[model samples]
Target chain A: MRYTRLSRKKRSIFGSVQLWLGDDHLLVVRSMRFTEEYRRFHLRDIQAITATEQPQLIWMEVALFAISALAFLMMLEVEAIAARIFFGVVGAALASTAVYDLVRGQRCRCRLLTEVSSEVLDPITRVSDFDRLTTQLEPAIAAVQGVLTVDAASMPVFAQPAPGTPPLRQEDRVETPAGKYIPLLLYFAILANAIAYAAGLLGRFNEGFGAAASFWFTEVILCVLLAFQPRRFGLKGPMLGFFYVTAALIAIDGIVTIALIVDLMQRIAEAGRSGTKTPTIWNIEWMMTAGKIAIAGRSLLGVVGLLALWLGRDRVVPASEEVPPSQPQP
Target chain B: MTGDLRCDSCQGGIPPELWNQQQGALCPYCGKRSWTRVFPAIQHTVAGQSPEAIGSESESSCFFHPRSRAIVACDSCGRFICGLCDLDTGSTGGHICPTCFTSPKAPGSGTLLDKRRVLYDSILLGLNLGGFFFFFWPSLITAPLSIVLAIWYWRKPRSIVPRYTTFRFVLVIVLGLLQTAIWIALFWSVANSPGRGSRGPAL
Candidate 1:
């Protein structure tokens, strides 16, 4: 039987391949460069042989991706009404499953290929005529090479590996840097909830639609960003951007929430002083005050979001270093 | 031999049936002996080196000659640097080591410190705003103080520091505005509510 072994160099550009012709004899091939032309193997020269199945992760990945898409679509209707509640549930589930599937797939691929390859191949040799055929084919198998290229400028400058170190192998994996987006999403959620609650309290829920729309729109955009590429705007980058935009919106929204809260408080205060039930939202006095507070709260969150972004400036990796490695696990 | 045979790879003792599994005696460490070769164990030692007391070793070594020891560690690379490689900056105390403390690569201390400080400032701003909402007017002082501190911090030579200082300043301003709005809303509600012939009808 023939066995072909391929091993990559730690620093050199090209990989090494060794072909064992039989129990005692072997053939060694070396090349300064790798080329597709070397991959062909002639089956006519082979007497008999067993084949090794290459490890693949297509099925598991497809299943998880399908599941995540399904979960996203399921929440679409509810998202139109109360997006925070709807997306919160959907996001939590999809993120969790995606994370789980990614981790499991990585472990399975690494272990089965590196540790169990020899054991699985051992049984294939038992077939008659397989050994002789494989021996002749071994040389061709050794020529195959794996190539990976990395853009160094995209990664954090602090963690850049010394030149000549192999580009990180795990770069192809998907990483969700949801930290920055979560806070921005949370800010919008809280602002929306606050506005809704205050508007309801003041009996002006209908008029509160503007603030609601703003809050919901911002929330949706943030959720979409998170779902699509969490790592691209990870850590502090998206948070700062979200805060600036949301802060502006909050500045507008806060006016409404604050107006309502104050009007309610004043009505209660006045009733205490003069001893009379406050007239409802219809009254110009109460309505106007509620309007002011609503606008204020809207404006407040917006500004607060901005401020959060500013104070969190260090959080945003500089643009030069903004492009994170394609994949950063954990 | 009279003893039981073993495989080197698996570390399992071999049975009589598999005694001649390959050409040679099995390794006791791992049971499998096929495709394995015996080699003498080698010990690595640094020649002409003497063991020194643990704390006595110098922190820095010469830049051109890494082995020549010096007292100070390079502020940048954390390498032991000797006198020839040490570049002295008077106020900062230790001389910067040439290898690790190159000017282009080394980040300024102020930049790192400012980033850390901004995080603290954000927390303070948030808390102060909360206080203002809860009717503690004195807590609003942080708003103005934060603005001043931010401006002062940012005014320094532009380094990585201003990014965080600006962030903190923005946070304080946002908090301040929110607190002011809350107060305004309170005033508006009190002013507009119906009264008992004092201002208007009680609502």
Candidate 2:
């Protein structure tokens, strides 16, 4: 077997990429190191070649987030109205930053490794672009690799099933069952909170109530999406996003929980001074106990779901990699 | 920005349909053409090349396949192997034969060749935590063992991923003394008791 250098005229050293075309494999060597490490991607082992453009993470956004987190520490005393308002603004800023990430975070990631592990070649940043390099190399890969992707959009029919028949094939149903959807329990808990939120809306619907209702409604929608669309949750960047978003939402829920506790304690103190039990639902000890139990259960479910998401982050393999054995290599 | 295409000018997220243009993607937000390169997916044939069989009777034959030509000898066991049987785990070439590589307990097996140092500190911390629950009795053996291990492996190598070790070492020592004190207290109470002589009445 002979090795030849791939056409390097069009290729630029934008993001530390050096590729060589071999007889039966692709020799990829990452740059910016004294001792070069070359990973040989065999044509037979390569399932698919996929690329994604993501924005580079900045230190400024991280610093801003740290400031937002520190704002929460200023509110030890409930009487500090100024500190409370400052915290509210910081929380809003952090939420806005999450939205900011969804927009501008795009760096080009080229996955040249096999299916088992993500042995990435190089991630191209703005300072270094690999568009022309990939354009030159794609043809070389296709010449040896063969066709890898099946575009669903190009196919007309997905096979509409007859009445009372199972539509999905057994192997195609590798998507986890409802029991494996740990986030569903969290979604149910959020829905319960949203229902109570809507019920409580009728008595007093002020500007603050409107804001709280909207936040809870947003949380309910996010949880529902996370619960039902388990397959989409496995997508690389979005999976990590789901984890962080869930954490942020849980933190907000905790702040609301603390406020409720403070209100309950105030009601109890008022009743003690009067030497009689308050008749209102808000002051009822049994109702308070039930609320505490529900909050504890919801928080417990959220923590469990977060742990599961972290542990099972790399569990889902790409669908393209699951090629059938019938089409054996010649 | 292939997955979540966005207009750099306005910093607004652009939908896939709006950005799917050959000439250049025109961002609807800022009305600027976001000219970027995008590549389609590639697939390959999953086949391996087979080694040639030996024809000459005088040539050295493979250990596994007697008819095949022997290309290299195993680094660990010195067994002759054909081109396909030479599994090189190391880059600098001491091409190990498949027999030594696949053998579970063999010295050259890939399992024992770890580059990153394992975290024994965490394991020691776990033992101390468990001993605390069992009320310092298990700590008598575990505390000293952990302390000894920590000091012994201190100069061996640090973790590939860095972590604090000073706190762990201090905690292990503190618990070791605490465990020793509990054992001493039990002995002191028995010796100072008024009915110490009749403590073992049944015996």
Candidate 3:
């Protein structure tokens, strides 16, 4: 059967998502490193398609700019020319990415709902692209399912229950919003890392590495929690992406921290044997490539995590408000 | 499904006023702008129904459920089935009974439920390149293994997405052979070295 590409493929580090219009179905294909997974929704079965503007992209832009500013500050403090160049390059790259994202327009999350499944169309990130998709798919879908002309304002089909439908139980009505404690966990971990970094730069070896160890421990726990609880916690969209990135950054940081610790131990042992003063951690860190990278990664993660926490903050409604208690406050 | 379209960010129900609005509306809970397009299928309620009882002996009954009237015949097994048992596979694949569709040995069951495709070409490429990038010693082990796998899966069904060439497989095979040859030559040279060859007498 012939297929027409519906949207341009959106790629990430791990995989890419694309949409294709098939003979009787719309196919969403997710291509990973070595395999391709498919989900197909028949034209007649689609109930609704939604596109919501995501403010996380704006937060991401702000975070990147903040990181660039932090890098500029670091560049001013560093004495080595190599360190200055590294900071300058990192700052430029992040600033350019932020500017590019700003110019590309707002991002959106598009989801397709059928009777059985609700699937995200990740490739259609831009609002304009979603509009195009709606225009193209509507006619084809209407041809199959026919146009529905209910007084949507008065008779929202989903708002009222069908005949013989059972009411939801109060016990089953409880909801655990996504990222309930995850952002806070990330916040504390980032704070610990920042303290550790500052302490390390000040030559307080024990205090610095101890804080680093705590950050590593927190990250390891987070990795395990994220693996099992992503869906259970109702995590979705950009917040989900943020947690994944945090997990990855921590893994890299773990390796770099271990290397730095090993190097520090050797330097301390050498100082003891030679009857000389112990070398400061900063003195050794500035001299190593892995140390520099660890420091930079820490700063980037800090900025991003702080912004994500701010954006994803939950609001508590007053008791006088008539809104349904089941509604998520995010 | 008896609710409005949910906010993409927070999963709260969107009011009907937000549906198909050109400017979009801010969600009451999350304040995110949601653009929703409702379709006829949303109103297509699926109420559960018990199978019709056989009123006359002339009417055929379901093969599995004898008391219930048969609505359609299973495409694969040709057995008369009730509406509940008939699983439609859209326009291409006809309706099938649950037994035939889920049966591993059924003739046409494989393609009907195929949700994923393992791209052996990409796997072979990764194996070949991973070994080379990490170290040459690993190539000694992975090279022969990849060569065997490449040949074994060479004729296996590839991705349904379609590709024009087998260039990746060819490249993998060539690289595997080259790595194997290099390892063999290195081992041969090491064994035949003058110092190593004369080591027995010196010991």
Candidate 4:
């Protein structure tokens, strides 16, 4: 059978997802750097398609891109010509992404449901894509399975429970405490480190270093608390692993910072004895390669952490809400 | 049927009354706008059935489940399977036993259980490119490996999506040859350099 491209490829940092229309089925291919996974739904088997508006998420992306672009623009004030050019290019790139996201218009979360499974059409992030997919799929599916009429409602596909069955109630559902705030807090702490590191690069070493040190201390406590009760925070798999990794990195950061501080103290003592001018702590030359590496690592982790959290946020649920056991989630 | 449709944001059931409305309905739980299009298949429901017991001594029983009466024979192995053990390959029109369905090597299993395919072209390309740029020294080993992989899987299917061109395989071969040639020339130049023996003796 022949397959034709149905939708434009939607890309993220890690991988991409695309849809293809086959002669008899619709294929969703998720392509990573090394491999591709395929999920096919027969045209006759599709039960329904739902497109939900996601204005808040689209606005979040716009704000994130705009704010990040502005933050990078701050580097233009740095004295180094190389630094200014590098940050300028980065800022321009971020600004362009923001514009692209805005021009794409509103986004939606579209899912295709069958009797056996429900699959998200990730490539149909834009509302336009959803409309196009539905337009294309509707006729093809209708040709195979025919159309549903208003009179069909009397059929009642779902069978009622036997007499005196207890209906699922709000109190019957499992009440999970809101674990959403912990991850948000972790994100804040990591972001603060990233900002502090940038400030240090711009001649505010003492303040930046102090701020980073304080945040790491706070992060250590937060990570430990979250690690102890991961289910409470609605974290599993990679999100849970992130907290463990953060704890390890915090320890490594502490060791590296303390070593740098001790070396700085020794240099100050030597300068006092020799009666020479004391070197400024803000001097990049004075900082060892290891110190520079540690700060940069922290900054990179912070950015990656933010993206990962945002992409996987759907799995997390608020504590105030209870999810019923009887109803299966799509 | 209402329970079948759910709000994406809140995971709450969407009311059946709003199933095919022109204007999207506000989700009762989260108050988000959601549009739904239901098809005729939504009304197609499968009724559950329990396997029957063996009525007589002469009656055929399920191969794996001996106590239960045989309902259908496996399309692959011809073994009788009860209702509980029969795995229907929907649309493919076959009733496969659990053992036959799970084993990819089983005859006719590919039609029922093909899920993933490895792209040899992509792997060959990554090995050649990543080795050459990131770790120059490792290319000595990887270059030859990429050459072998490219030639070995030249006719093998790369992607199920039908990538018509063999461009990646060709590129991998060319890159591998170039990288291997560079390493060989470097080794030759170093070994045959002037004063190479004399310098070593003086040391």
Candidate 5:
């Protein structure tokens, strides 16, 4: 059957709607008003759609997780000093990525709306088919859009709901503004940890301890809360919640490594002051042991979650095939 | 589908090849309909450095007319500032463009140092040449006033005119310190030396 691609500029009493007909010719109407549009589409109209890949965002996220994983691995190595250096590098990388992602994500989404499409459409129609579409198509669409666009008065389309409509419900899968801050906070924590670790390496032992604690309490704590809340509080679906939580756990592991390095530095400083062969004030072995345990626990959990997501990717609902009547039914 | 494709809104003809390029096609005229049988070539535009490259240049237009270009450069930031951006400095030839000059340079700027050095030298000259007169009552007040003026101006911000130089900073610190040292030496010498007048009981 032949499918037709249609795009209509819709303006209601409330706001504008940008519609996209996918390759499958499935109509995906993104209303500026709600997380989910009230209008439904007949699946037969869609042929297929090219997906947007958010590689910049995803790669950035993955890179951070990888660095955290590398830091954890370093802790397991025989050379304690080398492990500390690795941990510091990892902390710095994580923090940098977090900050970049947070700022970039906002800017990207903003730009995407203004520069690319005011609204996006996927060909899949049924809710059960979303998994296939998100995995196969959403990333492609994100890639095409590149960074989010911004104008003087407003951000990109998808960043917020349409004007004159009630706010998105908590149950909808859309990201809340508060959720955007999670990555930024994570990045800050990483930055703090990096500074502290550097100080330890430089032999400024006192400053290092202060830096580590500050990062742990501020960045790590916030990340942990962001990670746990979406699932613990049932704020969002398991897919998105998993991404946030896993990313947070990985970031926390990076922070813990920095703390352990601080402990080691303190011990070394004490040894120098006492002119002793072995330090009595602090135990390097115990600190290393604690770090290993944290890394192992977080990484294991993250790996499991990632695998589960990959496996369950096929079950998501696809966009529906039925097109709604042009006029509202009386 | 085999015939010439036309945009529904504008009735403009679409290239036949575009219909076969991808799964969906975009209309060239109204840009509304997507052709399901064909995709179009993705056109990319390279951005170049244009008049918009400098944002501030656009904002600071001519004061008299909003549309005119700002012809003058602000001594600060080297930005093109309009007539409205100009500010007057109190000194002779002290007209400072507002965009460049704000408050006086910090103590570290060379210009502030030069002014300070000049003030310091004037104080030393007054104190040394007029110290003998100060032995009498009237000259002492002028001497004290000169000293107070030197100190007061020394702490103030530098002038907008005659932009500050680095050498002036070093010169001021050195000259101020040397003058103070000399004044102390003179005071000590006169105070501690054997008294010409015997106010005390005869030894």
Candidate 6:
């Protein structure tokens, strides 16, 4: 209950944040230029302190393994010494990257009995620093709790507040990280739409406007969805307003494209029946079998991408992550 | 439930009868000058639900625990889940399995389900600053996006945390308008240059 400040120290955060260690509570205060925020947790509430190492070599390991596999597979064609040595070098590098990944890149987290967990301190990249930091914090927390102390008659410790002391921060709403890759999938769909459009342009849409309209229509849809992502995540209000506007735009484009496709197909049918098709029409990629194939492939990718977003809808966690797992029921 | 309160200093439980004593009466347990108060009564109610156990081959089993009974199916993936596997979807009003809830692509995408988000205000401010510090013609995209984002999300919810403020929204608009004005002036000057359009085509 004591609001008197004992000691204050600057901690690692986005801005000038301070850690105020008081008689019985640890208060963390942070603020941007205009806004300020703080959270207070009772000393006795913390349950566990964990130091986790997260290495940054998972991507490199995967890339190197693929290269190693490719090199090893090539050994069947060329039995030369260079091929064998190349495979050995890649294979070694991949193994070493995997080892480094396992051995390095760790972060620390503090678990509290109040159903919340957070990385109180900055991430520790080194093993020695990790150990030292945890040692410093564990004892400090125990000292404040009045239960565990280094000395039996330690300097008449801080007053032991009651067990039911209320914490300032009861809960934090964190967004899940479920459909994070949706943007990438939507981008791929956009790329597919671009290729389809290019094919339609090559097909000379003056004769068959349907092909060009459909491809461009699909492209517009991808753009709308991409723009809608931010609002879908957490950006609400006017961001949502633009989202609906974008949806309307895509819908209008869809309807127009459908009409164009129908008209273009009708023209093509009429041209074939009358044997009046332009000679250049045959050379157009959008009109050819290959163009249709590309269009089909891109459509499939777009569908799959949308499916991924739909499935991973509930997986977004807030940007400021640290919520720990809830305790299991007895 | 006993109508008693625990001492703030020593955590000694004091019964309701103790409230009739002096304002700063000495507690017999800790000998601390404690102040006893009568708090509003609380009615505690405990309810229970029996989770169905995984039975024969015909019955569904919990996804997390194979032996536990499948009481509720995950609303997201429709996978049969046990009571232990059921986690509250916060404000989403449903129960989901740990796997689907934690996954970044399982479709539980909402404000409650999101782990982190690209703060629109931050992006808007950054764009405004970028445009202001270097408001060249090439910052057309950044300037427009800054203005749009600032105006659009002006009244939107900022962060899930209640401590933040959206004062940056004004800064973004101010900076963005300044940058846009500079670009407009530059374009106007270029357009009115005596030689630009005049020299384009003598043909």
The TM-scores of chain A alone, one per candidate, are: 0.27, 0.33, 0.41, 0.42, 0.32, 0.28
Q: How many clashes in candidate 2?
A: 10
Q: Candidate 3, after superposition: displacement of residue A133 in Å?
A: 3.5
Per-candidate TM equals 0.24, 0.35, 0.57, 0.56, 0.25, 0.30
lDDT of 3: 0.70
RMSD of 1: 27.8
lDDT of 4 by residue, B41-139 (tens): 877775545778999999999999899999999988889999988977654426889999777567865442456567788888989998998869989
lDDT tens digits by residue: candidate 4, A168-272: 444333322233555666667777876776677555665576556556655665576666767655677887788678778877877877877787888889889
Alpha carbon lDDT of each predicted model: 0.40, 0.49, 0.70, 0.70, 0.40, 0.47
Interface RMSD of each: 27.3, 15.0, 6.9, 6.9, 26.1, 19.9
Stretches of model 2 off by over 4 angstroms after superposition? A1-77, A80-112, A115-330, B1-49, B90-94, B109-119, B133-141, B148-203
Worst 10 contiguous positions by lDDT, candidate 3 chain A = A321-330
Q: How well is candidate 3 docked (DockQ)?
A: 0.23
Candidate 3 per-residue lDDT over residues A1-330, each given as its tens digit: 566778888999998888887767888889896888978788888988999876444456557755765675566557899998998788768867755554445578899987767888889887778888888788889888898675553443444322333333333333334335545555566766766765655455555655565455545654666556565334557877877887777877777667777878999999999989998665664545555566567777777777776775554423332233232222
Q: Considering only chain B, report the TM-score of each candidate against the true chain B.
A: 0.32, 0.50, 0.73, 0.72, 0.27, 0.52
Error of 6 at B17 (Å): 23
Listed models, DockQ each:
0.01, 0.02, 0.23, 0.19, 0.01, 0.01
Candidate 5: C-alpha lDDT: 0.40
> Which candidate number maximizes DockQ?
3
Show where candidate 3 strays beyond 4 Å. Answer: A7-18, A30-36, A57-59, A66-92, A120-126, A153-330, B8-17, B28-31, B48-61, B110-112, B162-167, B184-203
Write model 6 residue lDDT over B1-203, tens digit each, in one string. Answer: 22223443444443333332332233323433333322111111113344667668877778777887788888778888887778654334267888877785676433334444345677677666765568465467777778787788777645434323367777777777777787889889998988865656767
Tens-digit lDDT track of model 2 for B1-203: 11322344444443333322333343333333344332232122223435569989898888998888988888768888887787755432257776676564456443322222345555667776677678757776776776677677566443322236566666776776676677678789988988867756695
| Sort by TM-score, top down from the best | 3, 4, 2, 6, 5, 1
What is candidate 4's DockQ?
A: 0.19
